[model samples]
Target chain A: MANNLNTRKAKQKTLTVLKFVFLFIYLVVVMFPFLWMLTTSFKPSSEINGPVDYIPNNPTMENYINMLVKGNFGKYMLNSLISSTFAAAVATFCGILAGYVISRFNFRMKTPVYLLFMITQMIPSFIMLAPLYQMLSKAGMTNSLGTLAILYANMTIPFSVVTMSGFYAGVSNSIEEAAWIDGCGYVRALFSVIVPLLLPGIAATAIFAFMNSWNELFMAVMFVDMDKFKTITVGLNSLILKYNIKWGEMAAGTVLALVPTMFLFGFAQKYMIEGLTAGSVKG
Target chain B: MKSNKRLGQRRNIFIFCMLLPAILLPLIFTYYPLIKGGVMAFQNYTLMDIKNVSWCGFDNFANILSNEAGVDFGQIAKNTVIWVVVSLALQFTLGFALSLMLKKKFKGAGLYQGLIFFPYAVSGFLIGIMWRWMFNGSNGVINDLLMNLGLIETNVGWLAQKETALLSCMIANVWYGIPFFTIMITAALRGVAPELYEAADMDGASKIQQFFNVTVPSIKSVLLMTVLMRVIWIFNFPDLIYSMTSGGPANSSQIITSYMMTLVYSMDYGKASAVGLMVIAFLAIFTLVYMGATKYTSED
Candidate 1:
């Protein structure tokens, strides 16, 4: 009996050590790219092509300065900010209304409408690529930031609606009903009673929508031709196409582009997880 | 009774008004483009000759299938299949393992979760560029590390080589995809009741047996749906390939969607539309089969 207990303890220790080893390896894998990018961004152009060093021997801010001053990265950042914000705002606004109605009301054709929204989530955005471009071009709306915002909002709305509805489904209807009995209309109750409760969900959906627009490359590259109106992703692609491989500047640009989403993700990590898992868990 | 009826009608109108933007935006942007794309697939359309476009009736599809005009559609289709399948397998396995590891509570677990999930927030295009630099032939971190460890004697041109180009892109894609599975599976795993595992333990089941019998069955639907969604998304994804290799090294890494993008770039709208339609059709069929298989199995 003592022998068996000793063997069990030994086996448990081995498993624990194995788990740590695996976790350490995963940590390395997840972190290596970002660490490399961070290091490369600070390296001088001369040292960039030299033997790869984990840490830059002589770090410099020249790349960031050059990107800001001469590369028009600032303008691109502004464009990205404008479009992403607009898209997220509009998508979330529309999502809240649609989500509320779907979750609260029992109407005819509700199942069909909900299914349509779900189906939209499955359809690849590429299928819409050619015709969307053609339609926008025909209307002479291509290359405009406002049009890009609308397009991004369209791409983000389905998921936003689904997420918003899931959040709404979580909140009990009793409070809203009480507000209704107290002589508040539906819109007033939504704003006064329910909207505050849904703040975290709204923030999560907004961050997701913003990230979608900010990270979008295919449509941005395809639709926008003008340099001034290009988003960060498009600008980075153009930089690659135009320049002879400038690794330092490119790395710096990538780091800068990653800032907003990373910052948002850091603060809203819980909400982001909740939002992304809503479909899988609740469905 | 008349007043109540009037109020019901007004409420319905209010609901409709509230949903106007959500309903109308998709109709104008999504369904409209989808229908137009189907129509454009059969028409001879070009951005340059839009005014004089006419019906072509499957010629574009025929041309692509036949490998006319040096497009090598067959090769592209094969590459796409390999890309999606290989990347999906790796990402799913790694992600599942990570999720399992993370399911156990430990010190700094939240920090690790944040770090692991950070990559999903990064743009695929930026990830492509970062990986492209890392895989550079002469002075890349990957080569530097490999050489230091004496694993490789020479710096291999990972992205530049024809054989390794697609694989390199897949590596980047897998990196980007891992967090998605990790986030999803972790969430699903968290939802699994601990009572199930305790019940299995009382039955003298080992950890492996419990995982297969209890954990797997519980997360089966989430796993199936996530995998299906990923397969379709990865199949349609062209951003990483486009940004990293641009379908280069003699189009060895070229996938169908990237080929479609090239067609679009060259202003061959009809061909692009045809390719788009083919992608939609393939995904539609695949989704149907997948849903059917899952439904059939769940009935057991």
Candidate 2:
């Protein structure tokens, strides 16, 4: 009996070690491309097409300098920042109001309204590409960053409403009811008491909206034709479309483009994960 | 009672005001365009001749379907099927495996999870750019790595060759998508009760047996929902393909959505709209059929 127990324990230890090894390998696979991009971004133009160096022989900041200066990437970043921020704000505000109504009110159109949002979320954004292009162009709204921001807000609203509705459902109605007893109107209670309580949830939803707008390539590529109004994705994509692709500058541009979303993920990873998994886990 | 009635009227107004923007934006942006696109699908809506826009019913659809417009819709349909099925299979299997390993806490598991899940935050376009370079015909990391590993003696033109182009994109997609499943399934796995495993153990069930009988059954709903959401998402995603290949080398890597993108790029709005309508219709039908099938199965 003692011998058998020892063998089983040894087998368990081996299995555990194997699992760790497997996990470690996957982690490397997951990270290798990003690491490669980083290292490539640091390498000089000459070293890029040469033997692949896991670590650059002599890392330099020239790529970054070139991307920011010669590549017009700063303009792209600014456009992205302004548009995404606007999109996030508008989306969050509308999402909160709609979510609050859906969660709290006993309206006649509640289910239908909620279903409208849900079904729209399932519909692909590209399906509207042609008509939107026509409408915006007819209105002379193409190439306008502000217009792009509004379109993005429209793009993210369905998701924002759905997610915010989930968050609102989690908060108790009693807090608002108490406020109502204190003579607070529904809107007043929502903005004052409930909004403060759901700040983290609001942040999560806004971050998601911001990232969606920031990362949107199709709309930006279609709508924004002018160089000055281009977002980061469009900027990077144009570089790829150019003949004789510049590897170093492209890598640098990609790295610069990723900073905001990656930083947001690091800062608010918890809320983002919670925002994503909360709905499916419960439902 | 009169005061209460007045208050109720005020509350209803407030609610309507609150919901107006959310409802109105979609109505203006999504619904209006949906209707316009539906109309444009049957019209000669080319950007080249916007003034001559007149109804041309079924011509765009017929041309695309019968290979009249050089689109090879049959190949595109096949490519889309291959793309969705292959990418979904690999992403789900690999992601599920990683989640299973990461579900139970181990030393440094959190950091590993964070690092592995980092790609989920990276945009699809960026992932495409990274992979496009990595899979470059010459001077690519994939080629270098393969040579080093003794897997291939010569460099392969991953994105240039018709055979490997779609496959290369699929690899990048798999890489980008694995993190989503990991994040989702890990959460679902954690929600599974420990007592179920214990009961299975007491019944002398093997580890694999317990996994299949207990853990899988416990997370079945989450799994189904996640898979459904992912299928729609993957089908909608054309960003990576557009960035990486642009359906290049005689349209070898062209899926239905990417082909629509090419039409959009060429300013063939009528054809693009037709394809868009087709996509929406297909997805609607697919969603209904999938939900029906899953609901039927689950009833047992």
Candidate 3:
């Protein structure tokens, strides 16, 4: 019995040690690229191509300063902010109302409407991209950020609605029914009861919609040529495109562009995971 | 009955009022452009001739098929297939392993998840640019490492070589996509009930057996859905590849989306539109077939 107990304890210790070792390797593989990008961003441009030394002997802010001075980094940052915020706000508002209607009322197209929204999301985003450019040009709004916001809103609303529907589904209808019995209308009950409950979903959808618009490089690169109108993703992409090869400055720009997105994700990660798992796990 | 019908009609109108923005947005943006774009596939249109276009019914398709449009689309189609199947299969496998390993009661799981999902937030174009920096022929981290490790005697041009350009591009894609599948399947794995595992454990099933018999069956729905969606996504665009290689090394990595962009390069939207239509049609047929098969089999 003593031998058996000793062997069991030894096996348990071995398993624990094995698990820790594998976890360390997993962490290294996952974090290496991002941390490399961070380290490379700080290193002097001269040392960028040197030996396999991960750390720079001398670091400088020359690349960041050069990028800011030589390029439209500030302007593009503002452009992305304006475009992404506008898209997120409008899309979330539309999604809230539509979700409320879906959750509250029964209509002929209730099931079909939900399915349609899902299908719209499933279709290749680029399938209509080329034609949309022409359509935008026809409307004489290809270069306008206002028009970009409208397009982004359309692209994100289906996702927003699907997510909002889930949020509403989770929040019981009993409270809203109580509101209705208390002489409230559909819109009133939604505003007073359901809206507060769906805050996390709205927050998640808003962050995602913002990310979608902010990170939209293809359309911006294709459509908007005017420097003043272009967003950050397009601007950085064009910087790389027009100039074939510049490692340090491009890395600097990419790093700068990625900062805000990481901050937003850091804030809304819990909600985003909940939204993702709850929505797609059933599929 | 008429009064009740009128009241019901009023509620229906109210619901429609709420749904107007949802309906109108996709109609104008998605449906209208889809039709307009379909028409472009039939016309000889250019960015310059948007206002003044001439119809060229099936010419683009026929010309592409016959190799008359200077596209040699047969080659692009082949490259596209090679790219989609290889990278997608690898991504699936990597994603599966990551999900399974992470699904087990391991420490640092949250940190692993956060790090993995970080890549997905970076724009596709920026991802290409990031990889380009890593694959820089003269001064890349990868080359430096390989040399230091004595794996290579000299610097090897990664993106410039035809043999490795597609694979290099695939490396970037796999890195970007691994997170999406991991997060999705990890969540799916969590939904697997403990009782099934307990039952398997009681039967003296090994850990590996429990995985195959319990875990796989539990997440099959998520697996199938993600596979379809990921294929649809990866198959459609060459934007990421374009940002990386631009179908370089004598068009060795040319896919349909990259081919489309090349048309824009040559100012030949007429042909690009046809390829675009083919892509959409292919997806449409796939959806129909998959849904048909599901309905037929599920009756059992």
Candidate 4:
């Protein structure tokens, strides 16, 4: 018995060590690109095309300055921010309303409406691109940030609804009922009581919507042609298409564009997991 | 009794009002465009000559399928299959393994989880650009590292060649996608009961056996759903391919969706819409079959 236990312990130790080694390697593979991007962003134009240097010897902010001033990245960043914020706000609000109704109320059209939203999740935005472009161009709405925001909101609505509904499902209705007994109206009770409780879930859903809008390249590239209207994705993409690719400035712009999403990810990671798993596994 | 009836009617009105924006958005944005695109698919609706637009009666579809279009439809179909299958299989397998390892709590697990899941937040286009530079023929980190490791003596033009362009994009797709499965499977794994594992252990089952029996069955629904969702998303995803290769080097990297994108760029709305319809048809069929298979298996 003693010998068996000793061998088992040794085996467990080896397994633990092996697991760590595997995880470490995976981590390196996953993070190496970001690290490389980071290092490359700080390097001067000369060092970027010169011998492969893992780290920048003279880490300068010249690339960032050039990208901001010359590349119109600042304008692109602003456009991205305005559009994504509007998209997130619209999506989250509509999601909250739709999610609440679906979760709390069962009207005659309940199942059909739910299925409609679910089916939309399967439809790729690419399919709608041609017609949407035509419609926007005909209406002279192409190259407009407001138009872009609306499109982004529309794109995010289905997933946002599903996610918010998952969250609403998790919250018991008893609390809302109790608030109602205390003379809180439905809208007021939702705003004051349930909304507070679902704040994290709402944050997660909004962050997701924001990230989707921010990252969208296809629509931004297609619907908007003007330099002033371009998003960060379009700007960075155009930089690559130039005859002489500016690797340093391209890397800097990418790093800069990643900041908001990365910052949001740090805060909303737990909520996002809950929201996504709840949306998928439960639904 | 009359007042109560009135109250119920009022509540119904409120509900309807709450759902109006949700209903209107999808109707206008999704269904209307879908219908319009469907019509445009059969018409000679190229943006270059909208005044001459007329119904072409499947001409666009025929041209594409018959290789009359500039792109090779057959090669594109094959590329799409390889891209989806290889990327999906590797991502699923590796992601599942990573999730299993991360299941048990250990020192610095949170930090490790954060680092691994970081890619999920990054944009697909940005990932493509990052990988594009990394796979650059000259002065790329990949070539540099490979040479240092003595794996290859000279630099290889990954994106410049038709053979390797799609493969390189697939590599990026795999890397970008693994985190999604990890995030999802890890969440599902947490919901599995420890008692089931204990029972399997008591039965003298090996770890692998226990995993197959207890863990698999418990998380099967989540697994099935995640895979289905991922499949749809991957089918839709052309951003990476677009930014990485732009479906270039003789259109070797072009998937069906990205092909549609190129058509849109050329202002060939008719052909683009036709290709878009093909994507929808493919996805619809795939989803139906997937659902049927999963349902049949679950029933069994």
Best by TM-score: 4
- Residues B1-300 of candidate 4 have per-residue lDDT tens digits of 999999899889989988888788889888899889889999998878979999999999999999998778999999999988899999999999988988887888877787789899888889998998899898799999999999999999999998999999999999999999999998888888899998988999999999899888988887887788788888888889987898989989989888887888888988988888888888899888998888823222
Candidate 1: residue B2 lDDT (0-100): 100
Q: After superposing the true interface residues, what Cα RMSD does each candidate give?
A: 2.4, 2.4, 2.9, 2.2
Clashing pairs in 1: none
The per-model lDDT (C-alpha) reads 0.88, 0.88, 0.79, 0.89
lDDT of 3 by residue, B24-141 (tens): 8888988787777778889887776767788989998998888897767788888888888887898888888777767765556665677667777677777787787778788787
Q: Which pairs clash in model 2?
A: none
Q: Can you write out model 2's per-residue Cα lDDT over A31-131, one digit (the tens) per residue?
A: 78888889999999878878778889999999999989987899999999999999999999999999888878898888789888877877767668888
Docking class of 2: medium
| CA deviation > 4 Å runs, candidate 3 | A1-20, A49-52, A103-105, A122-127, B1-7, B48-52, B104-108, B293-300
Q: State candidate 2's DockQ.
A: 0.66
Distance from true location, Cα of A25 in model 2, Å: 0.9
In angstroms, give how far residue B103 of model 2 lies from its true place. Answer: 1.3
Local accuracy of candidate 4 as per-residue lDDT tens digits, A1-283 = 9999999999999999998888889889999999899999999988988889998999999999999998889999999999999999999999999899888998999988988887787776666888888788889999899999999998899888888989999999999999999998889989999999999899999999999899888888888999999999889878978878889998999999898889998888888878987866654
Q: Summarize candidate 1's per-residue lDDT along B256-287 as a digit string, tens digits.
A: 88888888888888888898888888988998
By summed lDDT, the worst window of 10 consecutive residues in model 1 chain B runs over B291-300
Give the poorly placed runs of model 1, Cα more than 4 Å off.
B1-7, B296-300
Candidate with more favorable, higher DockQ: 1 or 3: 1
In CAPRI terms, where does candidate 3 land?
medium
